[model samples]
Target: MHNIKDLRKNLDYYKKKLLNRNYNLNIDEFVNLDKDNRNLISKKEKLEQEKKILSKSKNKANFEKSKKISEEISRLNKDQALNKKKLDFILHTLPNLALDDVPIGKDEKSNKLIKKFGKIRDFNFTPKSHVEISSNEIDFETSTKLSGSRFVVLKNKLALLERALINFMLDVHTIQYKYTEVSPPLIVNEDVMFGTGQLPKFEEDQFEIKFNNSDQRKFLIPTSEVVLTNLVRDSFTKKDDLPLRFVASTPCFRREAGSYGKDTKGMIRQHQFYKVELVSVVEPKNCLIELDRMLDCAKKILDILEIPYQIVLLSTGDMGFSAEKTYDIEVWIPSENKYREISSCSSCGTFQARRMGAKYKINNNNEFLGTLNGSGLAVGRLIVALLENNQNEDGSVTIPDALKKYMNNLDKI
Candidate 1:
């Protein structure tokens, strides 16, 4: 959500920035609505003044004029009420402007790679996809029979690996990265979803719960980011509590509405997957700096897992709805012969803060706080990378040293 005052004060400044993102709000509508609202207020004020004079005068002859003025004020009030609704709708449609440093591009094709890590393995034997590597333990037919397409059931060691991932990520984030671990509700209300910029614009991608046809809309969270960040909604913190870091491991549910044909073959895209999400709330001034620190925490997962990956700055058009700037961490997949996004660390600035009504008080002045979220790592996709990269010729996977403790010190799975 943009500060309407900023848009009113510097329309061209924001108009120009939004252009690089291939988006433009209809400022003309805003101008007309603002004009009408101001005019109505002025007219109502003058009418009220006239009524005040008539009342003071106690003149019977002024009664008709006073009655006419009253009706006009009532009419203006109705129009103002309707105008406010429309203005709010328009305001909600506008997306966050990209940060000036974000690469200007039409899409992901133009993303800029900021850094790369580890070496792409040179496999002696043709590497199999994660689906093939875990074929015995991955029961696709049963998944389809029970839950339909875009779902898979992991059995035996494969299922165990998923559990190990959740525990390992939670331990790493809580102990190593110093993020407070939180267990949040998976089913959240509409306001909670809206606070994180997941509703209104992207409702189709959500799984709205219709339990007993309840009137209140509740959704299965698409990411733990929705829950972790909303922890501060409609709340205020002291200046000393400048930065709040939270991490949660949970099952994320998504409809994959717009992603119809992509990654349909494997767990790369699923109806349900587990993720360890990281979120931070900080003073607006530190948002950009915090983004880098947050990304490092996420990168530590790949470092611990010994997975080769690269960090890419998301182009303007590729950023999330609330994100002003984003860094996508794409892990190497030997079978796909390309890097695929396993996590996205983003700085949303005050975009989500305004929506959440999250604030901080400094020197007696309350201001919106900045919010940041990232996938510490998506467990399912990380599993894909692990199974494919660490596969032995005989069809077993060697556990990475970092996860071995969580996996009961077993060397291989």
Candidate 2:
């Protein structure tokens, strides 16, 4: 969320930016409302102070005057509501500021590629798409009959392949990267969603449920980022816990709203999938290093699996709502004949902390902490990439060396 102060102090600058994002909020009205709110608070404070003095006197006339002041306070409280509504309207329009180095682009077409890796697949005979080759192993028709489109049920070796990928990622993150492994809830409250910048926006892309209490409701977490990042929500930790690294492998749910017919074939797009997520809470000065570390952790997964991939820096308009910068890892998919996003690493800066109120008391000083999160790897996509990249001419997948142990030393599945 953006601060109303920015809108009030730099109306002209934000006005131009707002046009770029297609947001409509009258700047003058917002500023006036904010100014009114300040005045109302001032008036309320003054009235309370005067009433305090009058109450000290404890005379009958003073009592009547205090009562009148109380009535005036009630009226001002009513006026404050209108001011608050206007203030909220403006705050909701505040755009997530792009990082200084983020490339200025209109959309994905303008995103810049930082690097590439490995070679695209070649076939002696006509190579089948993943959906074609894995047909005997995957039950998509039954999945659709049971659930709906964009769902898959992995059976036989395909199921083991997905499980092997998840285990490999979690082991690497916990043992090699020294991150604390956690099992977080798949369901979270609205405040947790807001803390991660999911609420007040992107609501339709989520799945919500009514809770035991009629007034309470919860959302199925769209990503472990919401659950992991909010662990320190509203917290003030010591500097020794400066760089808190967390990793979790969990099932994530998404509505895929508005993407009804896109990537409708297989696991490339799905309503539910498993992923090993990486999150870090670190000192402000150490955030960039943490981002690199996160990328390294994710890259290790691709490197170990020997899957061809590229690292691309997302453009300003392409970055997420909360991210200051983002690096998307697009794995080579032979079937699609193009790269597909398998993981995204981002530095959200203090955007999430500011919303969640997750902060730290720096050594002998008061300061808020910073937060960062990324996908160690999205497991289903990893399976898709692995199957497509390592497919044998005989229609079996050659297990990557790193996953051989997890797969019981089997060379091919």
Error of 1 at 300 (Å): 0.4
TM-score of each: 0.93, 0.95
Q: Write the per-residue lDDT of candidate 1 for residues 236-282, one digit (tens) a residue.
A: 97779778999999999999998888998889999999999999999
How many clashes does each candidate structure show, in the order listed? 0, 0
User: What would the TM-score be for candidate 1 when compared with the true structure?
Assistant: 0.93
- How large is the C-alpha RMSD of every model relative to the true structure? 2.5, 1.9
lDDT of 2 by residue, 1-413 (tens): 65555557787877766544445458678777888999999999899899999999978788999999999998988898878877875575355666667776777776789898776667776666787779988789899899988789999888888888888899999999999999999999999998888887789999998778766669999999999999999878778867999999999999999998799887888999998999999986777899999999999989888889999998866778778788999999888788999999998887788788887886577665778889989998988888888888888878888899989899998
Leading candidate by TM-score: 2
What are the lDDT figures for the candidates, one per model?
0.91, 0.84
Give candidate 1 misplaced runs (Cα > 4 Å): 42-74, 212-214
Query: In model 2, what is the error at residue 207, expressed in angstroms?
Result: 0.2
